[model samples]
Target chain A: MSSRLSLRGFLALSALRTVNSLSRGTGRGSGTVAGGRVGLAIYPKLLNDLSKNRQVILVSGTNGKTTTTALCVAGWGDKVCSNATGANMPAGHVAALSGSSSPHVVLETDEAWLPVALEATNPRVVVLLNLSRDQLDRATEVRSIAERWRSALSKTAHDLVVVANANDPLVVYASESAKNIRWCNIETPWTSDAVSCPKCTQSIVRTSGSWSCVCGFTKPGCVASVSGSEVRIDNETVQTSLSIPGQFNVGNAAMAATALDVLNVDPSKSLTSMKSVTAIAGRFAVRTWQGRKIHMLLAKNPAGFDALLQSLSPGTDDVWIAINARIADGKDPSWLYDVSFEQLRGRKVWCLGERRLDLSTRLDYANVTYEVVNDLNSLPKTSDTTELLANYTAFSDWMQRTTA
Target chain B: MKIALIYPELLGTYGDYGNALALSQRSTRRGIDVDVMNVSITDELPDADLYLLGGGEDGPQRLAADLLKKSSLKQRVANGAHVFAVCAGLQILGTSFCVEGNDAYEGLSLVDVETTRGSVRSVGELLSQVGENKMVGFENHGGVTTLSPGIEPLGTVLHGRGNNGHFDGFVTETIWATYAHGPVLAMNPWLCDEVIAKVTGNNLTPLKTAADQLYAERVTSLSSR
Candidate 1:
């Protein structure tokens, strides 16, 4: 068969297959396929074709992958052919590539799946969100993963655009291979455990809520940067002016905008788009339940969870921490110890999930006060306006029902 | 006391260090000083009152087990010293770890559990109802560990699991290993205290401060089933 005919035929088959897969996987009890796999298979070829006209941007992290991906895609508008659905894995990228019609693909690649997905998508630009200790049972060690990413970035010939989280030393070293790296950070006052430098393994000092590495390798105010508050995306400084409010979101938005700029998109347009996108389903999503404002932030790992806890202010009328014993939430919930729940002062937490008791006991040992609720259905029905900070599946179901 | 936190280089999963932290905190509370050492394949193992091992990915666990075999650590385990192993660390504490496709690697046999990589990987919050009480924690082990007879399983299975398919704390005299990943000691302060009691045989009083009182009040309010 001729190459052109084969390409057309392949696209057609992939599109059909994806539709079928999505339908099958849409049901609640269906296994993990969501048209993400086949979509990943088609990404490399489709993205390579766009190389003549535009650059590819790949976003991956334990959290914020979706928000950043959306920001970049919305920023590019007509210029980008993206899967901004927050699917960072291989299949998710393929699905996005297959659906997009633009020249550029703004893809979200999973950290665990980055090596395979990169080989498949081969995007020109890679944006790494902060590296946190997440799913220790399945994912590679943070340092090892970073080292692999550094090696992978070294090999990619594409005009490498490294969008980094400056507060995270691990991510800085991960994207070390990309010489054209632009650092982004969260300048918010929500200070937590992200204070170490990845290079010299030295402590980064935070002055007036803004952190600066004393390593001298980072240029003052120029090389090392901040989130929406300090980093200039388009021309505006990165800040919480966007739809998302968590301290991490500012960094995510900044990184997204930076990636767009690297892709030759006008920084102004990117910033404009950045303001329009909000939180993804699990990452700090807000939903109204029976006239009460329910804030939901997916706390997958200790870092993300720590950020969520740090981002949490003193005035949560009621807090519900929903933990799942599912594999996706880390087969072992032992990492919860690292989470400084001590910050959650005054507000009583409604601990609910298969792991509710587990969390409750941990809170008990830490002397954190919490109430245990086993039923997820009663999450909204319960009084005191509970904030359902649930896991992947539980949160998704809760959102769908509450919204519907 | 210097606590040799084995596999810190590979098995660190945030609060994974909390096991050490809790150990350190409780030890300090009882007027015991601890220097928690992070020893990996690259670093030499240190001496301590306790040797701890936590969970990580299969690759790292295998790598750590291989590295531990080459060290001068056997003398420590044989001396009836305190060793706290969780999940992957527990598996490595066995006579041999049978990971699929790989030959069963010899273990320290600090415990009676025999671990082999299983087709089914267990992950989630582990709640085991042991001895009339439910022990709450997390267990994300990819390998299935079977405890030998005469060994007491750690905790009761309230949700996720217990030791050797049993929802109880697996106890083998001086050695203690379990799938309790919730950094093991963070939620189970009693367990930490018990380990300390066994290791040192010191009647250290555990204080429940205003923090503990507040926690009880909150749980009482929230756990209204």
Candidate 2:
């Protein structure tokens, strides 16, 4: 494949490697977007070129794309190559694809970029985890993304199977047009994003583990269900002994196992293989810092925040909450209000970040008491475990500080 | 005081429901009792002193505008109920608003204003001079609102583009509307208190908390940047 490339294609693939190696060698960029940028600049259709003749599987949603992709990659073992780093864009896709000539490739696509990925990759299977409002500055309207997904799903090949979340009405609406589908009822708790039906302009009524709209947009009967810690697919229920902290990961595992089943992988082997991935990038990573055990969770949006908060509540622990409004994190921090901050009222909280004031104002309105801090050194030495919950760049900054 | 949080399922995008929390907490801080009714789409609109609406997507915004037009909201506003709305909430309160490139929808007509598609969608930090105090919040919307001859704007734009890039919002004795959504009330406690005062028919006492300090810091930092 490399020997028969045109002059531009050869240069683009070569440039991808040279730039990635140089960027990683220098401390300027993390080999995430730089190399891909240069490669795509030389060859506009670089992604399509790299994806040809490979069995592609796309994992995309508002949250857990990284974890779900990692689980799928781990399930396939050495046979699959993926963007293990948190780079989920076109450049990153091209760069990741340049690493190996493996016939199987799993890509964690961004929510808005899913339709683009669908058109580019023509994936054998599309995994729709869930959709909620995340980066409002970039993808402001949740329903518009659903509309695009509806169109993209309708246009895909009839043989293309979709592993979707039946718990999320938005995901159901997006995956409705797929001919081959397997829905998973993982009991997702966040319903703030989709209370209205997308097919018809009517209110959606949600019950336990299911929902229905008056105009007949109903939650389809799923093949997989997460009961307690076990994922039941068909009649076989396997206990998902996942090492991750939150129930959301249980949902991700269920979806990954179901998607792997579509790829003809054994359910037991796929779910077991997924258990090896305890932390995705820096998410759910814990380290000892400043004489206190610090647990770090990358919650970048309201959906993530709600999931993380829901998992770690009904207890008392001082949490260091950090927020940043950098371009990667979406410049608009207005979504902070979408989060349920009132849950943190009983816990002692510390706030610091680029946008701590905005976060502090949100906490103030929730009537939660918190102290503003300057740095990690100011953190009082305590016996109780202190957690670091940060969004995007704040997580990166804290992860860097702790690692350094 | 009865405060109605209207159609949260339809209009609670961008944390617009935080306004109800601000109003309730401020009222409680002043030793004033208040009832916050979270009105759903199917529930009948309850009679209340103040009605609060938040931002939403275009589809929900259109649905909410149609629903409110048929509801008792216009009658309540005529009977002197204080109303505070943000973004889509504000858009649905006007006479008419443009959406989806050329489609227009009829607003609730509570405010003598109209909205049209702007050259660019206004996003990011918004700062406006509200008489002596500068109000700061975040704005993300596509429509630019224009006032009628006899109407008044909420404030003049100071930093970000609000309304039509010169003015920030629409205001009258009974209605307060804006495109800013720092949950606006949480970012500007004075505006939250003022709405409560107008609805309760009692002057609010000087009550300070963590919000004022943070508000001052945002205004300072955003101004310098």
Candidate 3:
């Protein structure tokens, strides 16, 4: 601990620790944000102070931040502190750092809070996964977020290493001005948001594996690339065998490996560490519910849903799609139309959620037959394993209910 | 009945494509044979009895407006095509629309209205009353439109900031434009039926489904809120 802390800062930290213990005893919630808010209210710069003498690594983007952060922490081996339960704002960072005395920390940051978190932690490595439209009601335009990121990264004094996705135009455009960058060719299946270049507003030209624009912007030369289950970094090729299913997870693991590489970690040990991570924050977990096997998936935006759709096994048909329009999930449910629910054309889909009607409406247009079940508990019991894909609040609620 | 979805690539933001889907599903339920055509900006405008346009960002909205102006859309609308346009789509069908921090762009001039940026963005649940029916949906836009004299609105704003924080939408004999973009038609089935009745020139039987119950509940909840 830093001895230069003011008396007020010390008092705030003690209060936060007591509040966190009391909240956990009450068993209301994770107590991460609750304790964090208390601490931050007393000292607004608590995160900066807590993060001092710590080598922080921030993972931020529209999606996959949690999984990537988990993977990065695993690659860093034991004694790595992280916000493991998905409480990822500045308050969450304070709560996470306040608990552990580890000098190394990995954090998953929200998209809009990336600049603020970056300034506070001054991380040695910033891993940016990809940028896409998400929660338009709560978030500003995607281009505006990227512009802010570019402005923030350009002014940093330290030699910050940026692990960026080259395939996403927004990510590429935002991190292009960084001095030291480790680009990853992380393929994005959903290209609707990247149709126009963020810099020039012209249609981007995309080939099979690369994308370019009429202006001077294009996919940067990637030092790390993911091909199927294999990751290529420098001259070493490591076949990732993660318990998590999906190419997106593989891309996330590749980014983790590259981040570890920048920290001079052994490649074999990093890959070994990643293979042990079966689930992160309740995602990609196979659980038995009411004697029926179920696979839980979380998709917040069109790009995430598209990737989840592609990850489905060929013979798998039955699906349950739940959507909600809560403040956490964005009050507007219009993004439902942007998803290609047509991919579920022949599958038996059971739409259930606060906004199941919107999902059913989108499914109807996709020419898919669906049954709307208002009560999730009344869903018909099936012998076979079923896939459950839901948005943010729905997924969180389901996880809480099922686990409880 | 043929319905052409115009510039979906550029104008299909905010789930506006749901409007087209709503039309097709309702038409199929009514035993009416509906042929839906998706027309891109580069493609020639297809002649249809009804046309659908969705909302989009400012740049794509301008591109869609420019393309529609140059294409045969104006001619077809002049020839009595029933057109339903949402947020950006509504702005694009008007005479002119001013973007924030940019010069104003020319619209298709198919509707007797003009659009300007509002002082603040209007984003929330919008409830409008059109005749005996109430339409409920989500509205997220900064554009405030003013209609010319002799032109009537689609409905009266019950809640939320409608066009210029007062009226809801503009409606003429063959054109209807609104900012209520909860895939407006899906949440407002009566408006969907109205569009179909205007385009097909027939009073179709009402077909109710589980979706209706959801819509009714949502309307009640939104109105109460």
Q: Candidate 1, residues A1-404: lDDT per residue as tens digits?
A: 11322464467435535565558535332212244444334444533332334357778876777778877877777656665545565555545554444567777778877766566555667888867667666665565777788787777664566777655556666776766677665443322233334454344565653455667534223233553355565345533367776766766766777777776766666666677676664455667766666777776666667777776766856787878757666565666676777777677788876667667756655656677775655544553445567766557656775652
- Model 1, B80-169: lDDT tens digits are 667787777878878888653557878866566676666766655566655554455556655666777776776656566455465544
Clashing pairs in 3: none
Cα misplacement distance, residue B91 of candidate 2 (Å): 1.8
User: Which parts of model 1 are misplaced by more than 4 Å?
Assistant: A1-54, A77-80, A178-180, A185-224, A232-240, A282-285, A375-386, B1-11, B17-53, B56-81, B87-174, B179-182, B185-225
Regarding TM-score, does 2 or 3 come out ahead? Answer: 2
Candidate number achieving the greatest DockQ relative to the actual structure? 2
Worst 10 residues of 3 chain A by lDDT: A24-33
List candidate 3 segments past 4 Å from native.
A3-11, A26-31, A375-377, B28-37, B41-49, B101-106, B200-210
Model 2: per-residue Cα lDDT over A1-404, one tens digit each: 57435678788888877887776453332344788889889998778877888888899988889999998998877768688786788887887777767888899998878888888777888899988888887765888888899988998888788999998888999998888899998767878888888887688898766789888889999899887788888787888788788888888888888888888888888888888887877788776676667788889889899889888857777888999999989987878888888899888778889888878878887878888887657878987666789999999888877752
Candidate 3 residue lDDT tens string, A5-76:
567778888788779877745343333678888988998888888888778899999989999998988899
Model 2, residue A58: distance off in Å is: 0.8
Report, for all candidates in order, the number of backbone clashes: 45, 0, 0
**Per-candidate local distance difference test:** 0.63, 0.84, 0.84
Using TM-score as the measure, the top candidate is: 2
Better of 1 and 3 by TM-score: 3
Winner on DockQ (2 vs 3): 2
